[model samples]
Target chain A: MNTATAPAGPGRGPATHDIRNQIVVAATEHFSHYGYEKTTVSDLAKAIGFSKAYVYKFFESKQAIGEAICSNCLAQLEQEIGQALEGVEQPAERMRKLFKASTEAHQRLLSQDRKLYEIAQSAAAEHWPSVLAYEDRLRALLQHLLLQGRDSGDFERKTPLDEATDAIYLVLRPYLNPLLLPHSLDHNDQAPTLLCSLVLRSLSP
Target chain B: MNTATAPAGPGRGPATHDIRNQIVVAATEHFSHYGYEKTTVSDLAKAIGFSKAYVYKFFESKQAIGEAICSNCLAQLEQEIGQALEGVEQPAERMRKLFKASTEAHQRLLSQDRKLYEIAQSAAAEHWPSVLAYEDRLRALLQHLLLQGRDSGDFERKTPLDEATDAIYLVLRPYLNPLLLPHSLDHNDQAPTLLCSLVLRSLSP
Candidate 1:
């Protein structure tokens, strides 16, 4: 029942953050083996030599722990996509790189941290805030890119930007969706590139 | 272990099929509440007033019963799509109809029988033959429609038909996917038409 060593209040320091990271590391290991749903907070505490209350100080609930993991993974995916899009001037080529990079990045990320996909799948199924926030950011990024295309006169302005961004996001969603990614990576390795080409052609003025 | 009243031998007729249908109906009802993975054949037998042995006679395994239900539901979907396309001239229009019809029909069907979506999710996750077969048929349907567009000079033939079909199918997959469909129908009612227009614009000869 003791949580004296755990971080308290809003003014906690880096040591407190390390405790948070420790809990996440232990929870990830537990979730990877037993899955996110079946493992209880108590099990995680026992695995990490912390009291359940101690664990609670760091994460409000099992879902919060999952959210932390899900957020980090998505951030990594965003970084990979950013690297892929780097120095690309034209919106059309940027669009192509965006598709290919996301597909490849998602595949690599999930494949490497196979356990993380399980957490993400749960996050997606439950509409976790982390997933929603990521979706919002990605959508804004897409809308900005589409605006570039229209402004440069490289793409038609017939379709509303929101609608086009949504449609393109829909097409890319499967690659990002944990439930759908395995099939995409395993069977449809060429899909992202082909779909991007099709979308770009559709955007021609 | 008695299965005295069960139809036997290879010459089984409509009566045998009736028994099979009966099992599927009961299983669907049971699965709707308990879910597919949770319910066993014995539970189905008790619910259907049949001996477990007799139930096994009709369905060699639980998945067989599930397959029957999955196959029937997909058949209904195909029929609905077929009716949507009936008398529609022009491949692009037909394509539009195909997208709209499938999206609408899928939403209607799944919403009307909410439990059925649960079963479908399982079948899709497991890659049941029924799902694979249905995907194949739908792909063939799209390919045929695209070929018609190409022959009539409505669509550009620059992109290979296979790649176009696959890319388009990838867009539609989210709608067909049990995991993704609920979200699509609930939030993206206009996506089908918007995407179809985008794809059609891309196909301009």
Candidate 2:
């Protein structure tokens, strides 16, 4: 269904785009306050002063809305990492900044609100296709950095690029996954540095 | 509670020690057939022709019985790995065999019975202290092998023993964790070799 041509509400208060944005914003709050399983479409619609039917018009289901929030959160995280790596030419320095940025973003999300972290955990555990796509994008980013390092004579090309990427991901799993590294919350500063050091050593010529 | 003095059953039956062994054997079968949650002390006793009180005399609870099974399985796995590396003196060769034995043992356990695998998954997920102890033993084994490699000039001592051990575990998580490496069932032979190669390369002098 073309959402753009969908019938507008009676009152001239907000446009359809504004309503969609409002729904997402309110849904985020609801999800953050109440866990993914607890929040319902009726509760979301009641909070936003919209009919349940109208909420359905914008999102197909509660899971779809949760996915939208997860997608947006991950996209924002990627953008932050990208912005951090801008103008960083050296592969090692680029990787350091990338990991630092990724860890800090996750730490912030984990500390700011636990429900958001729960949503991410659910996304990963449930194998949401969008989350997997985001992981692929992250892996591609690492591969690009590795290739640059190889070209600059900083890293040895001892293994295939794909295998190397997998290696990096596996090695950094503890640092990347909050669920796996609970102690990281206490030693946030040291964990990333140690992990980055190991990665760089593995890539060293 | 001193279990040695427990009274024997009627007839020319086995002693209390044998009865305890019988309970564990019967419990393993029950857990492997019906899973951890479904199997109960009463059912176990009924299967072995003993009273529920007698089963309780042997095990504290159902979770305790599950832990016993998990501990026994992990101990047997460690013994198998130790036996595999019996004649190998070289650090690199020993590591290769250790990993190969570990992967093959886990694969065997996973493929032999679905219920057994599920019990292991539950044990790990629940973080049974016995399972954690087993993991620490495995990590110590890896650290010992790494130290041997460094002493014999097979591997570089670029990183501290603890950090290197952590790195090895991180890199080998997929190979070691059946849940993480689902694709391993198909490529069992190549997976261990590929993982060992990456590990050895990372530790190359």
Which one wins on DockQ?
Answer: 1
Question: What overall lDDT goes with each candidate model?
Answer: 0.82, 0.75
Writing each residue's lDDT as its tens digit, candidate 1 over A84-149 gives 888998999999988888788777767776765678878877888888898898888888899999
Could you tell me how far off, in angstroms, the CA of residue A79 lies in candidate 1 after the best superposition?
A: 1.7
- TM-score of chain A considered alone, across all candidate predictions: 0.89, 0.86
Q: Which stretches in model 2 have alpha-carbon errors above 4 Å?
A: A1-14, A38-43, A86-89, A174-193, B1-14, B38-49, B125-129, B174-195
Over the true interface, candidate 1 deviates by an RMSD, in Å, of 2.1
- Native contacts retained, all candidates in order: 0.58, 0.08
Taking every candidate in turn, the Cα RMSD to the unseen true structure, in Å, is: 4.9, 4.9
Candidate 1 at B135: error in angstroms? 2.4
Q: What's each prediction's clash count?
A: 0, 0
lDDT of 2: 0.75
Model 1 regions lying over 4 Å from their true place:
A1-10, A21-34, A183-186, B1-10, B21-35, B183-186
TM (B chain), model 2: 0.84
Best by lDDT: 1
